[model samples]
Structures are given as C-alpha cells and as structure tokens.
Target: MAEALVDLLAKVRERSRGLLLRLEGRYTVVGDLHGDYATLQRVLNEWPPPYLFLGDYVDRGDKGLEVVEEVFRLLLEGKAAVLRGNHESPAMNVDGGFLDELCEKLGRGCGAVYKEFEKTFAALPLAAVVNGKVVALHGGIPLGENMRPAPLNRLATLEGDLTIPGDPLAFQILWNDPCNCDDYLPSPRGPGAWLFGREITKTFHALHNTRVVVRGHTYVSAGCATHHGGSVVTVFSSTAGPYRKTKPKIAVVSDGVEVFDLYTKSRAACPEDVDLLL
Candidate 1:
C-alpha cells in the first residue's frame, strides 16, 4: 500500500497540472467528500467513471484516511480526476483532520508520507475545462474590477508547493465562495476570499467562452446549487459528519448540466432548488 501510494504520488506530480481541459464525452463531477468514505463510494457507484472530484477529500471527518486511500486507488486506476480543495493544502490539513488521521492510521512515522501527500496536493490542478464549455474547480474565480473574473489562463501554469501562507492565487482558488449580491464583497469566509456575485460569474464565462462553471466549497442544503443563470454550479457530495443536514449531490454533463441529489436519489431540474445558502 505504501509503495502504491508513493507511485501514485509520483505519477500525479508528473501528469497533473494547475489546469486541465476535457474536450469530449459526458462527465460526472462530484463535490467535497471531507472524508465520508461511505458516501463517496455510493456516489461513485451511482455516477460511474469519467468522474471529476472537486476536492476537500479530507479533514473534519472521521474517515479521512479511508477516503484518501480509496480516492487515490481510483485515481491510480484511471477512474477519477481529483482536484485539491482548501482542506488538502498543508495550511489546512496540517492543523485539520488529515494530518491527525494520518498519524493515527500510519503511526508517528507517517510524517514523511504526509509531506508527499502535500506535494501531490500542490500539483493538483486548480481548475478543469470540460469540452471548452464548462470550468470546474474547488472554489470560485477571484473577483476583479467591474465584477470581472481574473483570467482563466492566469491559473494555467501555476507551480510550487502551496502552503496556506503561500500563493495568494492558489489561496483564492481553494477558498473563495459565491454570493447572490450584485457585485464582489468581502467574504465572511475571511480575508483573501471574496463572495463573488452573478455578474462576475457572467463575465467569467464570457471571457473564457465557457457557459458553465462547476465548483464546490460552500455547503448547500440541496447538495447542489446553480448560480448566475446556471452559469455556475456548486455540488457537494459529503453527507456524513459535518454535513448531516445537507444532502450530497453530483453534477452530470451530457446535453446540459444536471444535478443529482444522492440523499433523495432524484434529479433536480431547477437552479432555484439548488440556490447557495449558508
């Protein structure tokens, strides 16, 4: 298992980038797991492969180690694409559940391995483009003047091992949230993160020539939410632990974006049903 993990780490370093583009085929995009292994498995079973996971695989849950191992195993098998969430970064994981989970599961000697995972996290792409029509990421794009988004190309070649006190760009990509207001505002999520409004979402799609942006960071009660007239969708797949009240969701991209509610085992057609709420 350790050897496989080491190999997976190396492969992710070489093959992964700060941004990726998917040009064809229907894809299933999942949201934050936060160490809910059972829910993760169920979602995978329901959605099948060609899956893109929107990070937060660890931390603040009891099954962090199990979830990480399973996700890595699937990744190695070419069954899924994993993006780094805020919880995957050293800044968040070092003090969150991931490190503690590692120490407890692999013993005190797990420090070196933990460092390797951090490196892997650093290499994970901040965003993905699907068929040039959608952009999927863990967090929303940064807000610029006139509610414009920072260019999608700016994140294309991002490098380096990101610590919390590290790259501001990466920090924003991993932490920002969406809002219903008309323009950008300071996020209650804290400094360095912005609560982006619908206009920003619209401008981002116009700038990138993409019609949709799929991301996960905030918790949505319906398990999924669409913003900016369906230009932005946030899907959350973790139902256990901290998200007991939230029904997990996954987004399916075929003719158009469709959100599946895992808890109710049904499809949500209206974006209003998936509104972003605290």
Candidate 2:
C-alpha cells in the first residue's frame, strides 16, 4: 500500500500544475468531500466526466482513505482534475483527520507514506479555468484595496512544491472566503485571509473577463449557494452529517451552471437573486 501511495504521489507530481487553464467543454465540478466515500461515489456515478474536484477529499469522516484512493485513482486514470484545498496542507492534517486515519489504517510506521501524500498535495493545482468563463478553486479570491489578481495566463504555470505558499496572493487563493460587504474585510478564518465582497468579484471578472467563480470550503444549507450576486458559487458535496445540516451538491457546467443534490438527485434552480445578478 505504501509503495502504491508513493507511485501515486509521483504521478500526481508529474501531472499537476499550480493553475490549469483552457478547460473547455462540459464538466462537473465537485466540492469538498471530507472523506464521505459513499457520497463521493454517488456524485461520480451521477455526474459524467470530465470532472473537476475542488479538494478537501480526505479528513473529518470515517472513510478518508477510501475517498482519497478513489479520487487519486480517477486522477491517475485521466478522468478528473483535482485542486488543493487548505486542508490538503500537512499542517492541517492533525486537526483534519487524514493523519490520524493514516496512522490507524497503515500503522505507526507510515510516516514516509504520509510525507509522500503531502508532496502530492503540494503538486495539486490551486485553481482551474473552464471554457475561459468560469474559474474553479477550493477557497476564495484574495482581497486588498490595491490588490489585483495575477494574470490568468501566468497563473496557469504556477506550481506547488509541498509547502504552503508564502506569497499573499497564493495564500489567499487557498484560504480566503467571500463576503457580502463592499470591500475586503478580515476573515474570521484567520489573520492573513480576508473576506472579499461582490465589488471585488466584479473587478476580478472584469480583469479576467470571466463570468463566474466556483469554489468550495464553507457548507451551505441548500447544498450550494451563490454569493457576490452569482459571480461566486460555493458547492459542498459532503453529505448531511454532524458537521453540517445541508445536503451535498455538485455543479454541472455546460451551456450554463446547474447544481444537483447528491442525496435527492434533484436539479435546483438558481436563486431568483442570482438570476437577476447573473
């Protein structure tokens, strides 16, 4: 198992970039799975490829290893694109459950495997641009009065190297959260991250010429939620559990974006406010 993990980690390193671009075509974007293997499998069965996963595949649930294995298998088979979430960092493993799960499943001497997985996490992309219109990532965009997003073209070549980014922009790309305010505000998540508002989202779209930003991190009651006037969408695929009350959802991107609940298997209309905004 450890040998296979090492090989998989190497494959992830060889294939992933910091940012992926020109992902043109119909695709399903999945949110944080948090080790809910059954729900992850259900989402995959319901949504056809090509698929993009917004990370947090492991941790917090009973089947972290199973979820990770399935996602990595798909990734290795060229069936999906996986981005890194904040939880992917080694620093987060203790609290996130991946580390403990590994110890339990692989025994105490699995340090090397754990380290290899960390490298794999570092190699995962930070974000992806689909059809040149929608941007998908794990967290939110960075915020600052004078801050402008890095060019999308350049971002495509960014690479991860097994360490959390120290660059403010890169850090925020993995940690920031969207807000309803008119400008950037301190994030309750921490000191470095900030909550950005709709105006910022608008500016980002204008700068990038993109229509929408899709991300995952926070759980929403409706399985998915549109913020920043529909310029930003958050999808959460983890099933209704002790951590959250909402059902899980995945975003389908074709002619337009549609969200489907994993449990109910029902398509949900975009909120009326989002309709007007978009």
Candidate 2 achieves a global lDDT of 0.76
For model 2, what is the alpha-carbon lDDT of residue 145? 37
lDDT of 2 by residue, 123-242 (tens): 777788888788888888865436655555655455544366665666788888777677677788776787777778888889888898888887665667888777888888886344
Worst 10 residues of 2 by lDDT: 269-278
Clashing pairs in 1: 225-274
- Give the poorly placed runs of model 1, Cα more than 4 Å off: 1-3, 144-147, 269-278
Evaluate model 1: give its lDDT. Answer: 0.76
Q: 214 in model 1: Cα distance from truth in Å?
A: 1.1
Query: What is the Å distance of residue 218 in model 2 from its true position?
Result: 0.7
TM-score of each: 0.90, 0.90
